[model samples]
Target: MKELLILVVVTIFTLATYYLVEPFAHSQMHKHVESEHFAYNDLPKLTATGDATRGAELVMGGAGCTGCHSIDVAGMPAPMDAVTAAASYGVNPPDLSNAGAVYDAKFLAELIKNPAHALLVEHKFDMDKGQMHPMVAFYGTGGDLDQEVADMVAYLQSIAVKPEELTPAIAYETVCGRCHANHYAKWTQIGTTPTFKYEKESLAFQIQVLEYQDSLVKYMGTLPPDLSIYIRSRGEHYIETFMENPQNYLKGTAMPRVGVNKHAAEQVIEYLKDSGDAKRHEREEVGKYVMIFMVIFAIFAILWKKQVWRDLH
Candidate 1:
């Protein structure tokens, strides 16, 4: 009866500490920034409904998105090759094939209108120092900017593969693949490339990676860390909050508020876990059995001690 009472007290203490004290301490240490603190929250609400057809024409021709980015759908093949595009812009422009599926619509419109503001890196752009973001702001050709942006978004959405069909690779590519590489997953900063069979292909890939890295350093003033082990290093909570608003975590960080919604963020975290901690599930499964064994052994040990001391008592 005494042992049962002690166990109940200990369990209650642990639960109370975990549910109450830990949270209070953590909140005190880290000021909890709400999701509304994200830069995308400041973007004006879109007024015009997007027209996919008009957006397509604008993207391909008037908006000149193909000059930097590749849509990969029917009419909108990449105009410039990856190397040329990377040379022209500091980084290889992401393929817009999944932009609609991956990014928030308002965020995309803001990205088109003001790349620096959309990316939460306006501080890095200084006209005096000649430091500018690689992606230029879209000033549409004397047209209704809102409608044009809406149309472009609609066109991107139209070309997007269904969200349900998006694999981890696709999700990561659209979100983090531009700035970060996952070597463990064989995903490069540019895109996923199959292992090269030929030496020349391998060498070419290395050169491309180097060029991209160099450009990134110039653009951001620092190389973004490889995300291969970030899940293990930083843990999920840090990554999620950092992605939501990097400025909150690291003030004046060149990294942008990625504006990844919770669903997509969860998918990204799952992908990171799969890559960095492949054995986590197996380890957890084994741990459960070990815990059971320990509990059984402890119970038997207590019973044996009671039996041995019965005479003395």
Candidate 2:
């Protein structure tokens, strides 16, 4: 009788702990991001219609974006390699290949107007020196800022790659691998390693790409975290929300607002769900049986105890 009572108390305590502590534990991970949330539908609409063709012209022209970034569209040639660009700038600028698919148009326009303002980055000016780490305002397209931004946004959307089918692994490699190299490398080691799509590239060029990736830590101040366990550490909603507007989620974080649309975000999240917990389905199935066994065992134990104590009573 005493043992059964102890078991009951233990089970209750465990359930209480899980119900109470789980929420607090989850909240701590997102404490930095907590704010009065607003629906995205409430935001203001864009003023101008985007034009991809003209946007490509701006991207290639003296807006000087190409000077910093590397675009790999079919006709566009990267003027400078990734390594050279990262060496020149403190960080490797993001690839704009998927900009159309990833970013919000209004967000892109705001960023172009002022990078620091878009990011909400604080700046302290020194009397001896001018503004430090200031991104040059892009007023290209003959100084018509509105038209320039509109064209850029249009171009980004136009150039977005659409695939009939995208696997979780493919999404991770193409979208998330650039920054999360460690996670990619680890995942590759565990699973069947994927063949490089650029296998036809010259050996020297491949070497240069590898070297550039290795040197990213030098420029990025710290290597961005591996995403191997990111899905587990940060839940799907947190990841999706963060990708949408990093500044809103984690103030002062260096993670720029990515241009991923809802569909793309879902794809990445689906992939994460699989990659992060390979045994999730199996565990859930096992849990049901375990609970049933425990219940049956408890009943049997109680019946036996009652039988043993009836004589004493």
Candidate 3:
């Protein structure tokens, strides 16, 4: 009993020390970002509800979105191929088919109006050098810019895929695939392929990937790392907080605050876990059984000790 009591006390002390010391040590190593630096908190709210039909017209014709982006549902195909688009725009423009589904409405509006400001990347722009964000800002000829933005958002929302239709892979692709590749999941910036049946197709895909990466490097000054192992390396909490406001975590980082709402963020994280820690669910299940077995074994051991030492008391 005395030995057991000492072991329990030591375990408690170790746990207490770990819980206290780790956070303090981490704080010392990394500055804690204030809440003010979180861009989502300062998003411009919509003044009026949007009309989807009007928004569709604006996106298709007035805004000329199809010149750069593709909306398959809207029958707007990409004007340029991936390599050409990347070379021209510093990155291939993402298909807007699922944009409304994955991104927050407010963010979409802001992104259309001022891509740099919306992405918290205005610092990258240099007025003196005439360097601007690749995405051109949209200021509608209409008197009410807010109404036009709202209409476009409404159109996107109307055509967005149903919430249930968004798989983890799709969500990840829509949200992060443009920058980060997940080799484990067979996903790249351009698209996904499980296996290449033809060498020609394989080579073409590789070339496209390289072109996109090169363009991104020119735009952002560094290649974004593959996300295949980030879930395991960075852990969930860190990824979640970092995604909410990347600038807060790494100031001057080209990574934007993507404005993924909670549900979309969860789906993206799920995809990362699926790619990085495929056996997490199995490990958790095994851990539960192991804990139960230990508890049962401890009870039996205590009973056995009492049975063997009843006379000593």
Per-candidate TM-scores read 0.84, 0.66, 0.89
Arranged by TM-score, best first: 3, 1, 2
Supply candidate 3's per-residue lDDT for 149. 89
Worst 10 residues of 2 by lDDT: 34-43
lDDT of 1 by residue, 1-313 (tens): 9999999999999998897778778788876655543346677888999999999889888988877787776556776766666667767788888888878788899999988888788888765688777887899978899999999999888888787877777778889988888888888777776678999999988888888788887766788888988998987878877888799889999887776656667778888988899899999999999999999999999999999999998
lDDT of 1 at 98: 82
lDDT over C-alpha atoms for residue 114 of model 1: 88
What's the count of clashing pairs in each model shown?
0, 4, 0
lDDT of 3 by residue, 53-73 (tens): 999899888988888999988
**lDDT (0-100) at residue 307 of candidate 3?**
97
TM-score of 3: 0.89
Between 1 and 3, whose lDDT is larger?
Answer: 3
Cα RMSD (Å) between model 2 and the true structure? Answer: 5.9
Instruction: Identify the superior model by TM-score, candidate 1 or candidate 3.
Output: 3
Candidate 2 on 1-313: residue-level lDDT in tens?
9999999999999988997778767667555453222223423457778787888888777577776666777355555655665555544565677655655566677667666555444332232456544356675656567877888888877776664354555555545655665343354211224456666654555566556655666644466676766778888767877776676666666665554445666777777777676678999999999999999999999999999999998
Instruction: Go through the candidates in order and give each one's C-alpha lDDT.
Output: 0.82, 0.63, 0.85
Top lDDT hit? 3
**Model 1 bad stretches (over 4 Å):** 1-32, 36-39, 126-132, 198-201
Q: Per-residue error at 220 for model 3, in Å?
A: 1.3
* Residue 312 alpha-carbon offset, candidate 2, angstroms: 16
